[model samples]
Target: MLIRLGYEIAIDCPQPMPVISLLDVHKDRQHDIKRQTKVLTSPFTACDVYEDSFGNSCRRYMAPQGGFQILYDALVEDSGEAEPCNPLAGETPVEALPPETIVFLLGSRYCETDHLSDLAWRLFGHVPPGWARVQAICDYVNNRLSFGYGYARATRTAAQAHEERVGVCRDFAHLAITLCRCMNIPARYVNGYLGDIGVPPDPAPMDFNAWFEAFLDGRWYTFDARHNVPRIGRVVVARGRDATDVPLLHSFGPHKLTTFKVWTYEQESYPVRPPARGIDRTLTTPLIG
Candidate 1:
């Protein structure tokens, strides 16, 4: 199936500010692009594109005072299959896990594994380790937290979410990720385009979505605690230890989000074409704020 996805966002700045954006589709999905992903800026400036440490495509440029608008659109192919489910997938012992995967097992900005370690063992210690253990953590998060747009808080950590029992999708991901890390299951936060494709259209406005992935049986698998069901047409943009590492945009100076819109839906007649040349796949040190 073909899915059309992209966004139009604008920010108002009081002065020139250095900004980095993680709005492009992930490096892993570049081959699925049927239509080239093109990014345009209003009051155009030369935007330098690069790859971040996590392998996410990033754009960096100096934002001039006033409005900074960004636009991009693309047609990408999807398998039209629900996220894979493997209840029997086994977890590798911590000592046997790959060295690179060890970082995900540690606590990060939004997911404080240290604070939740005791509770995680208390609530999930009895569950059989491996896929069952991960599912149990998801089940607990799905039940404990109430999803509400109004409850969204950027600074909410996993422990706080567990205490308040309310937050947006990122909170669901953070809490699940933290619990998984505490259980020795490597997990990371992911944000992407998850539209209502094989389901009823939502009444609320569309926005970028958040989910998570867990390393199991030598590979990572996707999981969504907020929905707690297999979903289709997930076009991932970025992944990191938590939301702090993968926010859509980060600026050196204050900026107000003046416009935010995202779209991801089936495009029945999207044409497929060969990839263009000069697409760099290497990571570059970005001008960090």
Candidate 2:
């Protein structure tokens, strides 16, 4: 499968200000499973952009701007390719996990103790003493949660979503991460895009996707509780201990958000040629605030 994605971000600040920086992770990786054909980042104003690879070796772009009317856009094409399974599931132990796994366990601070432990038990009950525990948890989350557009606020936690019995992608991811952490499995929050899931395109609308990553056997594995399956066109932007660590965008001053919108779509054809040269590879350091 081939996918073309377009993303637009606009910020309308309450007052005119100076200095704005953003980290973008849209460059498709050149690996076995997928190929990035083309990627273009457009800013409304003049800005400096840099590229760097972070913890997972994913490419990221950074831009710094001045004043208001901050707009960022990117276009990317990715081909559906399968990657080799890490196979960490067979050798690593639950107690002795990787760094990524450890971080995930410590990041989720709001998951209910009993609920999370129950999930961990479900995943670990059948596992050999020293193996990765992500697949079971992923399956459980996918089976347990129902995908819906509106169930709670964007900032709601896994415990809240579980009590309410409804949640969007982010909520589901959070719930899964919380459970993984509770189980001593490492899991983190991921913000990015999932191409149009048979939805009609609407002008001036917003469509962003959220998922989670579990640290298992020896590496970070991507899991989508909402989709239950993973494939290409799944671009990861920012990842953190929780939602607070990887917000889509943050403002320093008191800026009333007047409007926000996102849209994702797929093209009918695949790329006929390879990617172009001279693609910017500058890394942008994220500012937590």
Candidate 3:
């Protein structure tokens, strides 16, 4: 199957601002891309692309004072299969696990495993280990938190989210990742495009999506506490210990965000002519305080 996906974002700065973005297709998916446009910006800001420690492609550039915009679109090749469900995938012992995966088993900025450890143990101690245990965690989180855009708190931590019982997809991912770590499972945060395919269309505006991956059976497997069901067309952009590590945009100076938009869907075929760029267009708005 072919999937079309991309994002358009516009921001304004009073003066020059250095920023980094993780909006490009992940390096692992380079082979899966049929064709894509280069990351493009309005007013043409020079950019340098680099791979972060987590292996996510990072685009860096300086936004000139006034209005700055970014746009990127792509057609990706997918197998047309939902995420795999493996109930028999057993958890790897801490000592026997990969050295790199150990980082995910510890605490992080948003995923406070230390604070959630006792609760996780008390709630899932006897739920049977391995994939079943992770599913149990997802089920609990899916039922525990109320979903909505209003509950999206950038500073919200896993413990805080569990107490509030309200949050967006990142919170669901944070809580689930923390609980998994407390139970000695390596889990990491992921953000990317998840179009509403093979499901009812959503009336709300589209935006980038958040989910997570847990190390099980010597490999990482996808899981989503927010949806708690297998989903199709998951195009990953970045992975980190938590949202802190891979925020879509990290600006060194303050800036006003004027627009943010995203799109993804099943594409029957490619565009007649591939566009020569990337990022948000039609952002002629003047900068404001």
Candidate 4:
């Protein structure tokens, strides 16, 4: 299946500002792109692309005062398969886990392992270490919190989500990631375009989504605490210890978001199509802005 996806975000700044955006389709999925992802900026500025320490592609540029817009649209081919699952995938011992994967096991800005460690152990220590345990954690989070876009909080941590029992998708991911770390399973936060394909369509505006991946059987596996079901067409945008490491946009100066939009949907074959262009339809350089 072909997945058409992209976003348009506008920010207003009072002075020149440095900004980092992680909106590019992840490197792992770059090979599947049938149409190049393009990032167009209004009142354009030159942008340099580089991969971060965590391996996420980032765009750095200086934005001038006034309103600035970032836009991208592309079509990517997907296998139309749901996230893979292995019931018997076992967890690797900390001593045996890859050195690079160690950081994911520690606490991070949004995932507070120290605060939820006790509860995590008390709730899941008895369960076998592996996929099943991670599923249990997702089950707890899915039932514990009520999903609501209105309940979204940018600063809420996993412990807070557990106590509040209400939050958006990121809250669910943070809580699940924290619990996985507390259990000695290396898990990392993930954000991307997850569309309502092969399922009933959601009657809401499309937006970027967050989920997570836990290292199991020596590899990472995707898991979504919000839906608690394997999904298809997850075009990953970035991954890190927690949300802080992969914010969609970070500006050094004060700014106000004037516009935000996202899209992701499966396309029927033989009709070769491209995503509809934004109002400011001018395309930019390097194919990836």
* Candidate 3 per-residue lDDT over residues 195-242, each given as its tens digit: 999999989888899999999998899999999999999999999999
Clashes of each: 0, 15, 6, 0
State TM-scores per candidate: 0.93, 0.67, 0.95, 0.94
Instruction: Tell me the whole-model lDDT of each prediction, alpha carbons only.
Output: 0.88, 0.55, 0.89, 0.89
- Alpha carbon lDDT at 33, candidate 1: 86
Q: Cα lDDT of model 4 overall?
A: 0.89
What lDDT tens digits, residue by residue, belong to model 2 across residues 29-116?
Answer: 4232233322333443444444422332222333323223332334444555532345445434566665445556664544554656
User: Candidate 3 or 4, higher TM-score?
Assistant: 3
Error of 4 at 83 (Å): 0.9
> Which runs in model 2 stand beyond 4 Å of their true positions?
17-23, 26-68, 72-77, 82-88, 94-96, 109-115, 122-133, 197-206, 268-289
Instruction: Evaluate model 3: give its TM-score.
Output: 0.95
Screening candidate 1 with a backbone cut-off below 3 angstroms (N, C-alpha, C), the clashing residue pairs are none
Order the candidate numbers by TM-score, best to worst: 3, 4, 1, 2
The candidate 4 region of ten consecutive residues with least summed lDDT is 280-289
Best of the candidates, TM-score: 3
Off by more than 4 A, model 1: 271-289
Instruction: Give the CA lDDT, 0 to 100, for residue 164 in model 1.
Output: 99
TM-score comparison, 1 vs 4, better candidate: 4
lDDT of 4 at 49: 97
